[model samples]
Target: MEKIFDNTEAALALKSDSELERARFLFELIKRDTLVKIGAAVTKFALKFRLPVEGLIRSTVFDHFCGGITEDDCLPVIDRMFSKNVHAVLDYSVEGKEEEGQFDKAMFKILKTLEYARHNKAIPYIVFKPTGFGRFEIYEKLTAGKKLTQEEQVEWNRIKNRYDRVCGKAFEYDVPILIDGEESWMQDAADELAESMMFKYNKETAIVFNTLQLYRHDRLDYLKELHQQATEGRFKIGMKLVRGAYMEKERERAIRLGYQDPICKDKATTDALFNEVLIYMIKNLENMALFVGTHNEESTYLVLQIMQRCKIAENDKRIWFGQLFGMSDHISYNLANFGYNVAKYLPYGPVRDVMPFLFRRAEENTSVAGQTSRELYLIKNEMKRRKLVKSV
Candidate 1:
């Protein structure tokens, strides 16, 4: 049967033979659980002590997953994807710095990204983490209903100012921006700020987007509530939907704190909820702009099926699909090839700075059952086909 993800040539169009070989080797390592565990530990130790393993990592997982170590370095990757009809969302992948100076630097970097995106028609969106501009402790306290100290009040104001500057620039450039979702504890603050920005900048169009993680049992309802608010408020809602990245951390935290887990009970529940939200947003497409960020083939097929049933155009500006830059090219390239609106989340940063993001990608592949193996199978199939074509 023909499948949405069956177009291997479209998927691997931009990959060199050497790149495919590297991916195959990396996925093979990721598929071995014992090796992954040992590798993760060794990587952590080496990075902690500032060992010279950067070259090994840069050539392996980093090359497979990230765009490059700098904005200029990402131009070729961006141009290559755009050549295939896929757009880009430039994501600054730095994480886990809390100093005020660090936050200021991040804000400057994001604004620079937006400025760069302004001239590049290939870049449709810019994204940043809220914690990149504010302290996690401040968000946690705010979410918990605790009053901020006098110093924190000033800090919060600065955070708000940074958000306004970013959103305002996005609006000025007529480019959309995504405020990524984080842990449940700090999500409330992010949501509140995102909604406020949407109200300000999304009055005419969805210039500011908020992310919703559907792995939480409560998020589907949260989506419905936001739709209702948008209806009443007479503004558009821009939403980026994902199955979430912090499931294990969320569950463990709930267990440790003796509270009800906020996550869906199982993967099936999360999957059902994700599809339900997708359908709901599609049905309400008039007032909603949806960005579906997922690697799941079933979810991608579900969206295609619903759009076909609803007679939505393949090139609708209000709807888009996204996958991480280095993964899920089958879905991205195939959809783009067929004239669907698709973009890759192209994360870029210094090698040392993006290590956390890189590590998470590796851990996710290893821990998620069948993920690495599936990637390996696709690469092998594509390689065989290419070899056959050459021989002929």
Candidate 2:
């Protein structure tokens, strides 16, 4: 780990001066937590009231954080990233839909993405939220060991069918699909379902990747147990390791419900757990594949160090480094420049439907200590370097 992420030239190679300035402006705005909250409220209200705010939103935060409104809209970005050896995972960013029709539509969108991935070398993977394919209540009910009514049972079967269909299509296309992690209450059902998919489609390799929110104290044990099961069943395991996004919601729910908090005690505990799991996965790379999704330079470096120590190739097909689009370009691009596999999570959807995802990105940048500041620092450094060169 020789300070690879500091190379801003490689990181910002794809951004023009105007695009760089836009990124700087976005991060500067995201640095103010109060402003982010107020903006989120106003944006929600505007969208709900059908105000003429889409243009403002699209020209600012939306363009910075999202790919476009549809899969075809994402082709240029995907091709540009691939030119630099970085891949793309086109995530449809719609959220909070629960109707069967909506679920069916989401499944169709994913199937289309899989077909695109089959033909496009730039788009190596596709992702979807479990709730996007089914109702949250169904997952919660199932996770709680509650029985479903006749109607609910039919809904559950439809959800399972959605999973099987998309997974089977992904397997047929030979493109890995990442199933995202959600709240702890609903995740048990999703985890069990992901395991079954892996067992069914991952006999030769890991085609179905489940997400692990490592912020939870128990997920390491869960991963270990899953690993043991995969070994016993003789199927490869695929996992995307993340620190989780729903910490506050999880805490509030546990407190309200009088249950144990699922999150770790503090940031340090979470970081330690993440590192421990990283090491464990690297050590057992033969039986599994990993997608390391983090913006933390130290954690990214930790993975690089472990890979080097283990004598793993820089461009290991079974391991990938991923960061969200419009964030952490330094990490994503620099890793790719160094011959490592990297992918940016390119979220695409209608401006209104994608607001929740954008708001989360804003909140995350504001909540995570020093994240926005680090991004600003890198952006300014690159801008200053370019200016000095011009003056010279």
Would you list the C-alpha lDDT of every candidate in the order shown? 0.91, 0.94
Tens-digit lDDT string for candidate 2 (31-125): 99999999999999999999999999888888888889999888988998899999999999999887899999999999999999999989888
1-392, model 1: which lDDT tens digit per residue? 24868678989989999999998888898788788778878988998899999999898888788889889999998999999999999899999999999999999999999999999999999999999999999999999999999999999999999999999999999999999999999999889999999988898889899999999999988888888888788889999999898888999999999999999999889889999999999998888899999989998999898888889999999999999987888889999988999999998898888988877777777767776777888999999999999999
Candidate 2 residues lying further than 4 Å off, grouped into runs, are none
Query: Please, what is the TM-score per model?
Result: 0.98, 0.99
lDDT of model number 1: 0.91
Question: lDDT: which candidate is best?
Answer: 2
TM-score of 1: 0.98
Instruction: Enumerate clash totals for all models, in the order shown.
Output: 0, 0
